[model samples]
Target: HGGLVAAGEMTRTYLWRILFRDQVPPETALLLDNNAEFTGTVRNSRTLWQQDFEQPAPGLCGTPALQGGCSLALDAAHPHSTEWVIPARPGQFKWVRASAKARADQMEWDMNRMTQYVIRFRRGNEIVKARTVRLQRALVDAGWPRELHFDVRPPKADFDNVSVTFLYYGTTANLLLDNARLEAFDD
Candidate 1:
């Protein structure tokens, strides 16, 4: 099978599911937000996750959104967002690559809050794991958006949600996020 797409269906396909092929190596999108671009309408869209961050103190945008003149903005006081992607069936999977483009309005080596781009996994309200790309002052100072990716190995297969959010530990600073993606890889 080729050019096959499945969403929120509890579906699985490989070179073969009845007889697994390690060499063929199955790669499928358990959650699909390829560019993390928020370009959908209610008429036809993926309704599982927060498609756009226009609520909870409604903001400008989400995903690779500078193109749309918007991005998911996060500050220290408002540290995290929720439900970027929800897998159709999380228990059948082991590894996921979470990615996003991040840019900070301000970052300093010792700022009360230094922005960290994160792929957060959750079983419910509890955070199962956080994979982070710690931003350096110099990188932010360079004035170019950084795209980051990391593999998440959940301690268990029960993680119910995946979020690409910007988190700040301290008390000040802002981070802009775009291009959120959560993709599954078979192991």
Candidate 2:
């Protein structure tokens, strides 16, 4: 199965719990905040912004991290593009992407405004295949919701490091990412 295991097949939910929580584990003290570096700019009556991941909140998943830590980044030079990266264990892992209630409105706008966000992976020297999750209209009606669960198996050749990116249209508004979890599932 490489690292692609079915989360439902797990015997205990402890691993799943730890992977999804926002709080840093005492044993792993290397939490990074990437949201602090975002440079907000307004363009053509629109703006793009980014946020960092500090600690995972309860019932949340997939905090947005940038090039350094999990956070958001926007390049004014490319007015229509914004990027979000999340770092995880270098293997086949399943992630649950979620957001907070406070950011529900903006999240809904971003989903419905422009094209859908695209998710991709980067290894040492090569970029892997890309996956996309379209925003559902129902989610917007409820409020700007968060996340589309992604189950991906990264390239085995580059187990030392891996990065996941979300490409958004320049018109996308603010979004808050939280509660990111990675799980080892049964094949």
Best by lDDT: 1
The alpha-carbon deviation from the true structure for residue 89 of candidate 1, after best TM-score superposition, in angstroms, is 4.8
lDDT of 1 by residue, 70-98 (tens): 77766544566654556544654455665
lDDT of 1 at 30: 16
Candidate 2's TM-score reads: 0.36
**Each prediction's TM-score versus the true structure:** 0.52, 0.36
Give the per-residue lDDT digits (tens) of candidate 2, residues 1-187: 2132224433232244346665523212101101111113312221112234443232222234322234332223332232444554443343222221222234333333432334445554355644444332213333334443333334444433333333335434444333333333323
RMSD of each: 12.9, 15.9
Give each model's whole-structure lDDT.
Answer: 0.48, 0.33
- For residue 181, model 1's alpha carbon misses the true position, in angstroms, by 1.3
Best by TM-score: 1
lDDT of 2 at 151: 36
Off by over 4 Å in 2: 1-52, 55-119, 135-138, 142-147, 153-160, 172-174
TM-score, cand. 1: 0.52
Candidate 2 global CA lDDT score: 0.33
Q: What is residue 34's positional error in candidate 1, in angstroms?
A: 22
